[model samples]
Target: MHSQPSNEDRPWTPVKATGTALKGADAGIVIMPGDALAAYTAVAPGTARLTSSRPLCATGPGKISCQGIQEWTVTVRVTRP
Candidate 1:
């Protein structure tokens, strides 16, 4: 998963990233420094839900309009041939 933080939002951080059927390999999930938010891999036939959230209010000048936080999610389904 990837997140593009807007000017009024802070960077996204991982929240719930765990599953039972699939395992995330080290080689498959590459940690790109200062680039991507997160990476995952599906090593088996199963379903996984990746979620992340960021603060709605970003630190900067001016009046802060946004409050609370925002979230992002993706469901990955892998199958065997």
Candidate 2:
């Protein structure tokens, strides 16, 4: 969660494209400035992935078109002990 890749101009944000095994502690997507700290609760015994994505380049006028994307993932496993 710490020392990960991040951009100040274009920061990395969570991708809720699919269902996740870990549910967010907050009501909705929680993203703080210059930080990606968030809590999640395991709903069931399974494996889940928390992901974040960012464009390769900053999109703006006169800037190079962003043709690629970068992603970061953290795998979480929940089991009954």
Which candidate number maximizes TM-score? 2
Clashes of 1: 0
Candidate 2 residue runs with Cα over 4 Å from true position = 1-8, 17-20, 27-35
Clashes per candidate, residues 3 or more apart or on different chains = 0, 0
Can you tell me which runs of candidate 1 are displaced by over 4 Å? 1-9, 25-36, 60-66
Q: lDDT scores for all predictions?
A: 0.60, 0.65
What's the C-alpha lDDT at position 59 in model 1?
Answer: 51
Q: Per-residue alpha-carbon lDDT of model 2 for 8-80, expressed as tens digits?
A: 6456675442345677676476556544556787777777777787777766677567678778777888784
Candidate 2 lands at a TM-score of 0.62
Candidate 1: worst 10 consecutive residues by lDDT? 30-39
User: How close is each model in CA RMSD to the real structure?
Assistant: 6.1, 5.9
Over the stretch 1-79, how does candidate 1's per-residue lDDT look in tens digits? 9565563346567435656545644545544332224545567677777777776766556736577876877777778
TM-score of 1: 0.57
